[model samples]
Target: MFFRIINRIQPCTSQQRLLSRSPALQNSLLQQFFDDEENFGKQELRAKKRPGRSWTNEELRLKSSEDLHKLWYVCLKERNMLLTMEKAHKATARHFPNPERLDRVKGTLKNIEEVVHERNDAYYQLETGDSASAPKRTVTSFMGFTYEKRAEEHYSPPGEGQKGYEVPYLDDDAYLMQKLWNEKELCKERDRKDNLARRQLANDEMKHYKRGGRRTFDRLEDLKVYQ
Candidate 1:
């Protein structure tokens, strides 16, 4: 009976010694792994770090298709992460650093779309019957200048004459009358100002000539003798 009790006590003592010897075993035994002050400090330090900024075009161009695809996912994840962080910050009444990161992500997405469009346009022009360039229609403006209007796909019925859509007539009697009246008035005003300016210039020249003749009055006898 005494030997059995001693063996049981020896096993319990050995187990305690083993637990104390290993930090992991001690933590497992106590259930206090995360309760350490150093780990808590490290967590706080990691949380304080700001994420990287926007991606450049060169960097994006250099990336392979696989990399670009992965980048897209990463950008999406980053946007979501920022949003979540922003929400949490707002909840906690703290200022979020680098708020423009969301806008940068949006700009990057737009750039990606632009690049995709360029590639699609090149591919479509090579394979399809239609040109990738924008369709244009010649239109006469109110000023009688011909301009090209961009053509877009539409399913609406043609308005008025079916042969060709009638451009709303700016040459209607009322509109023409108003335009002619304005033009005539402008021309008349311009002519009146021009004539006034010419008359003033002529008068100034006459005065200058008279002053020259007066200055040469002492030479008037020499002039008569020569005559």
Candidate 2:
């Protein structure tokens, strides 16, 4: 993927002769992995700027599917190369310039994915009356906690790659346990509300007393009593 983009980039003239003479030129991966510099290791290291703005969703949506696919790989390869360069610079205690360049690439990739997902959803809806979005269901864990589980692809079937595997489903006992837990939580919540209401009432009484509205028999006790 890197080689394909490098072959397409014709502007780097100074490195052309050097690249032609290098034995690694025969290997596309090695040739494109390294920066095209004659004085690569001999000179001071500095951050390099990315050439242009990231692809916008409008621009990507206008492109053909094949073109979008090609662009996605190109951005992916460029991101990998940038990260590799940054890693090397960090190892040598050198500063990498314009770290926001990575964010720009990442944003573009995210936009591209959203566009692709939209298209997929539209196609599936048209053909099968279903969206391409992953299916999700409410599932209870072995510990009796319930959560939404989104479907995903795995290399192996469930319970295949791990020991003592438990499917995320609740039995009658688990349901009963969860029900009891909820009841306890509700009781705690009601007690908290009652305490809060009493505190508020005490505060109001204190305010009334401060305004000289309390009688001699009112006691005029501190609000801390309610707490």
Candidate 3:
């Protein structure tokens, strides 16, 4: 699979071929995915000596919206390319080249999304005097733990008009499970306590033996008690 991509992918050479045959075909999705600039050839199968560094938050913040948008897509495309390469390598049971490129591209995409979110929030607050982030609520989960649930648009408040989803109450089966778990824990605690008491008794016997000489001690009986 890796070799197949390498053999067929000629980047600019392929684009030129397409241009000569039909200029309209150059704007195809396949051409877009098989971008012409980067190493669409076999060279990409080998690890890079040193790849470009990840985009910094400060650098991303300075870019205009349009420029940032374009950069985001470029990063996205690079990520897709890396993932495809990785899949091909894995399918052939080989190691992917330049694994760090995945992390770098992922980080860049995260930074881009964060910057965009900040900008959107600022704009939303300026215009509407409210936070732009999704509305979330603290709700209990089925396991009896609090979870942050993002509220979705509904006809009415949850659990009022509709059977709005709520953290489920423990049923008979759940109660039985909980009881069994508690019993198991209690048994463990009892066992641990008994073990500790036996250890203390054994230590005391050892102290007795140390105080009295070895000849005065009943070594076999003491060992039996400890065991």
User: Candidate 2 at 178: error in angstroms?
Assistant: 4.3
* lDDT at position 21, candidate 1: 52
Error of 3 at 160 (Å): 3.0
Candidate 3, residues 1-227, lDDT tens digits: the string is 33454333333576435333443234566444443334433344334444688998899999999999999999998888678756655655555555787899999999999999999999999999866888787665444444678867778665754432455576666567767878899999988876765666555667777653233445677554333
Task: Provide the overall lDDT of each model, using Cα atoms, as 2-decimal numbers.
Answer: 0.55, 0.65, 0.66
**Model 2 agreement with the true structure over 33-119: per-residue lDDT tens digits:** 555443233333343423567888888899888987898888888788677656654555545555566788888899899899989
| lDDT of model 1, residue 135 | 71
Those runs of model 2 whose alpha carbons end farther than 4 Å from true positions after fitting are: 1-31, 35-52, 152-227
Cand. 1 Cα-lDDT: 0.55
Which residue pairs come into collision in candidate 2? none
Model 1 Cα lDDT, one tens digit per residue, 1-227? 22222122111345435434555424554333212222111213244354455677766777776777777886776676556545644554545555676788877777665565666687888899566667777765555444677766668966674323225565675477668878999999988876565454455667777532222446666444222
Q: Is 1 or 2 the stronger prediction by lDDT? A: 2
